[model samples]
Target: MDRITTQAPALVLRPWDPADAVDLVGLCQDPALRRWTNTPVDDEAGAVRWIQEQQRGRAAGHRFAFAIVESRATSSEGRLAGHMVLKNVTPGGASAEVGYWTAAHARGRGVASRALRALTDWAFTTFAGDGLARLELLHQVDNAASCRVAQKSGYELATLLPAAPPAFPRDGHLHIRSRSAQVSALVDATRR
Candidate 1:
């Protein structure tokens, strides 16, 4: 698996490490996060398992999970701020879904939005040759914050999926960014 990094003005998105388990456990304890995301890091062991799963996904080329950390001048710097991932990569590699959660302390700081933008841009360019043409971000309709993040990251609201059993038990909004020729041409024509 290739290690990838994306730097933004305030944050750096990098691959997860086993050492992040401590912070991951803390993040999972946030009530807001637990409510909005299906985070499984309830204990040290769960955190370890989570990190291991992330590694497995990366090795399988099915997911790229990044730890969002604050950038500092020194090597020993800022702690874990959040996490963002591109998952559900299609067989042809043309599309993937993005998901993210911000730690309690990182809320209202634009961390999620910044990380999302950096990851989205990196994924689009870095994986273009591997058939990555589009990215999708879905959030439950009530998650206004996540919707804001998606919009801020340049994803357009595509559709509202009906409440489906098993996966989406509630109505969800799907946002998408496309690199397809048709979409590009449309964007270009609109700019002219």
Candidate 2:
């Protein structure tokens, strides 16, 4: 399947573009975002490279990286809120990993949670035919806030990956949300 576009009340997730470099750099400046995630707002050059990589990833079909942005802003004045990506998508495509962050100012407003839910819904719905079995979230163990977000989004803690993966700076929580479970939970919520 091709990359998808997801929208929520506060934000829209679209394919990343080169023009997003400036706002993306600003969003990555939050130390909290950088410390736990690989996102670094080092320089314009870095942003340029990231934009290029997003394009390359899309072309290669290994990833889908979106530019999380506000819905109301004109493109020229729109802020780069952050990003959400679905990576390591399988040939069966039923499984994928999600990662996301919001700008420092956007924290606590449920942006990340909403974005995660939106993406999860899309992933399960759109990729179900591809054996889309499950989706997972990875977060540092000390990041209680993120853990809460995952819980709120209906992901259950699956394991404590003892060793930090090469890309992770430290050991963390590995949470999983299976498609059938997610659908059942959503159905239950709507019935109440």
Candidate 3:
């Protein structure tokens, strides 16, 4: 399982490791990251716990979480760039939800979109026979940046979801990309 590193054109998606606690903690310090997702890394202990949770989730075939790393020749090589996950995956189910948050330093660099597309392809391939068909990407309606990332990753707007406070405090948008989709024009825009 640890050997399951996904190679994207510009990023590497690997499982979270204990040694990444410091960087994860630092990434969580960015207010925007904290504001968008329920990050578990507030400190080193929390980071370790979060990493362990990811490990257990992976072992149980429930969640597939990855620590995004830069692989660009000119990029900050090996730097922790973001977190991405395919959650709510049910065996023999047709769909699952995807989520991610780019580190403050990694924002505006296409980190989320690249990592998302790469891992999405991985998930579809890995679960090809398990009936997995669509990966849903949801973000609060106010998160314009996430919207752009979703579009750039080939996920099209599917619907609007009403807010459920204390969890999802804002109305949200649901984007879905089917396993058979061709890379979209929005994704082509990102490629340029």
Candidate 4:
């Protein structure tokens, strides 16, 4: 494992690296990520492209993505357990939306919750000097796990933004969860 970045009791969240392409490909291949996020690469070339784009996105400051690494009882340090990507970030920017997926082998172990909390905390403070007001998670209403993550991350149900599904066979309903006064309260309560 590389040096721990955003450390909690058992996990570390750090920026994505170009060298992480292979593991990232494997991470994206998890069925859960495929169902919720954009499709994973089917070939090495595609994975390479995705990794390059992520690197570019990071350099351009248009988006930020991090790997969620965790320590296991058997491992001395931490290992990449998942990924978290935050898009459209700017100080006092209208809003930043977060997306994440846990590794297939690391699900249901509080990894997502811990990472989300850390990410949200960073988002909240990143724009404190500016007028940045809130963060949001635009989730498909049917994705209960993500809804839980959003809730745990200090977002409250703000509104529903409706749309059509990509395949056109299904209706798309987008639920928007926003960080508001309640989130401030959550921050106060959770901050040590």
What is the alpha-carbon lDDT of model 3 when measured against the actual structure?
0.85
The superposed Cα distance between candidate 2 and the true structure at residue 150, in angstroms, equals 0.5
- Tens digit per residue, CA lDDT, model 1, 1-192: 233344544687778899999889988898999878877788999999999999899888888998888877676348888989999875667888989999988888788887887777777777777888889999889899999988877789999988775566689999998876435655787999
For lDDT, the strongest prediction is 3
RMSD values for the candidates in order, in angstroms, are 3.4, 2.6, 3.8, 3.7
TM-scores of all candidate predictions against the true structure: 0.87, 0.88, 0.88, 0.79
> lDDT at 97 for candidate 3?
89
> Which residue ranges in model 1 land beyond 4 Å of their true spot?
1-8, 180-192
Q: Write the per-residue lDDT of candidate 3 for residues 97-123, one digit (tens) a residue.
A: 899999998899777887888778788
Winner on lDDT (1 vs 3): 3
How do the candidates rank by TM-score, highest first? 3, 2, 1, 4
Which residue pairs clash in candidate 2? 94-131, 94-132, 94-133
* Model 2: how far residue 80 lies from native, Å: 2.1
Candidate 3 residue-wise lDDT at 45: 95
Query: What shift in Å separates residue 13 of candidate 3 from its native position after superposition?
Result: 0.4
How many clashes does each candidate structure show, in the order listed? Answer: 0, 3, 0, 1
lDDT of 2 by residue, 21-48 (tens): 8777777777888877886458888999
lDDT of 2: 0.79
Query: Which lDDT value does model 3 have at 132?
Result: 93
